[model samples]
Target: MTFPVVGMVGGGQLARMTHEAGIPLGIRFKLLSDTPQDSAAQVVNEVVVGDYRDLDTLRAFARGCDVITFDHEHVPTEHLRALEADGIPVRPGPDALVHAQDKGVMRARLDAIGVPCPRHRIVADPADVAAFAAEGDGFPVVLKTVRGGYDGKGVWVVDSVEEAEAPFRAGVPVLAEEKVDFVRELAANVVRSPHGQAVAYPVVESQQVDGVCDTVIAPAPDLDESLALHAEEMALRIAKELDVVGHLAVELFQTRDGRVLVNELAMRPHNSGHWTMDGAVTSQFANHVRAVLDLPLGDPRPRAPWTVMVNVLGGDYPDMYSAYLHCMARDPQLKIHMYGKDVKPGRKVGHVNTYGDHLDDVLERARHAAGYLRGTITE
Candidate 1:
């Protein structure tokens, strides 16, 4: 039997982590990296150095692969279509990926599909933003660049027309939405296979700081069981509707009125599902590979009653080696996954996962370890 070689585009930590998952399954991962120093390139043995933006570069890199997938959503749709036309399998194909590529398109499709979502519109200018805001509570609207945004960038919670200028400066259509009075953020993660098989993981509560994910609590504490199942169903419906054949992370906003509204969608493995690396029966990285390859999926059930994942944002401390040693000595059970990235302030360099029957204990262990890695927690 010939093992299918999967070629992943992008050189970030996501690709690096996915390559790790492919190891045990005897899967060969080929990567197209922007630079030889890129995170995935450093570890993935088959590294093709090229820019994904150039059609020629992408064409050459995809030639020998059994299938191609992405570590990011930035690849141009036309290029993917070109590859698809040549009989190259592109998991979560370009048609479905476009929704994740552009916020406006995602919102429009979600509305059309009857998925619960926030009231949003594509506004031409800041004045148009105010016009939409007026239809609601007025002012303090959320503005986002229609495309090319992630990790807290390209998003603005504008309290006034002047505050909305930043997103407009991006020179892309701005998506204006009513500022949701959300109780907390949640993520419903699901994986779908090319054969139409699918599975949903437990809904997770995600906490953000300046729009970047900081911590995640799996099986969000005391979340209404019916609502939890509804979130999962919505995610599954979305995958089927969009023809998404890989991991889909639906970021949600649970409002003060207790309704779950779709906030964002990610076509690839997302930060919100990182808890699954150690907490679940199968990690998102592994499922993404299996899904893209049309293999039978692994289980999504959690290994424990509660799992807490806390991101280790880069701080002044660059000595992760020292921190890791200390954290390992302190909580031997803690599972820390480092990205092999250079430390930079506020960048997600790694994460720590801890699972236990007690929520507080699990959260503390994960948080303390992550904080220590960031050199924030002492004693």
Candidate 2:
């Protein structure tokens, strides 16, 4: 009996972890990577070094795979459509993925569906950005390039039109939105199979540091139960409406006024769901694979009362072996997952997950381990 082949485009840590998840099930992975050194390419045995942007390269890569998936949203939508036209199943097909690829499209579609979102509009110029601001709360408006931005690279919170000019300079369509007055950020993660079976993980509170995710707390301490249910239902509805057949992460803003507004949508495994690696009955990567394969969904229940995941950002220290020893010896319960990437300042090299009954202790343990690994905490 031969296992099915899953073609994963892009070679980031997401693909790396997803490949690991498939190991137990004997699922074969074919990876298309930019370089042999890419995170996933280092581990996936069948690596094809090619440019995902090149149609010929993509066509060659998909020839033998049973189905195609992605480590990121950057793949050209037309290319995905082309693959589907060739009878290759692309999980989270182009129609649904285009929304995540383009901010303007996502905002427009979400609005049409009556989803709660911050006031926004596509702005053509700095003057238009100012006008958009005036239409809302004014100044300190948020500007984002409609495509190709990630990890806070294509976003700006500008106090004036002068500050908004940079986004338009990229020559991409720019989306202007009101700066949400949110108390904190939240994430609702759900997995959907092609046949419509779906499961929602507990809502999680995600903390960002300079636009990059730093930490995630499962069950979002003190979150209203009704609102959590609403967020979960909303995510499930979105998956069905958009025809998404894999993991969908709804990045949200829980406003100070007790409202939750949609901030962003990720159509694959996301940083916010990282805690599921150790804290949940099934990891997001494993379930994502199951979903794309149209297999039974897994239980999304948490194993512990509180689970905290802290990202280990690269710092001054390039060699983390010593730090790893210190952290592991100190907290044997800690789970450390590292990507095989060379450390560079501010880059996400790995993460640490800590779970327990007490939220504070869980948070501290995760933070301390991550900090120690990054050389931010000596003791």
lDDT of each: 0.93, 0.94
What ranges in model 1 sit over 4 Å off?
Answer: none
Pairs clashing within candidate 1:
none
Per-residue error (Å), model 2, residue 172:
1.1
Query: Best candidate per lDDT, number?
Result: 2
| lDDT tens readout by residue for model 1, 71-93 | 99999999999999888999989
Q: Candidate 2, residues 1-379: lDDT per residue as tens digits?
A: 5789999999999999999999998988999999999999999999999999999999999999999999999899899999999999999899999989998999999998889999999999999998998888789999998898889999999999888888887798989989999999999999999999999999999999999999999989999999999999999888888889899999999999998999999999999999999999999999999999999999999999999999999999999878878898899999999999999999999999999999999999999999999998996
TM-score, one value per model:
0.99, 0.99
| Cα TM-score of candidate 2 | 0.99
Which residue pairs collide in model 2, if any? Answer: none
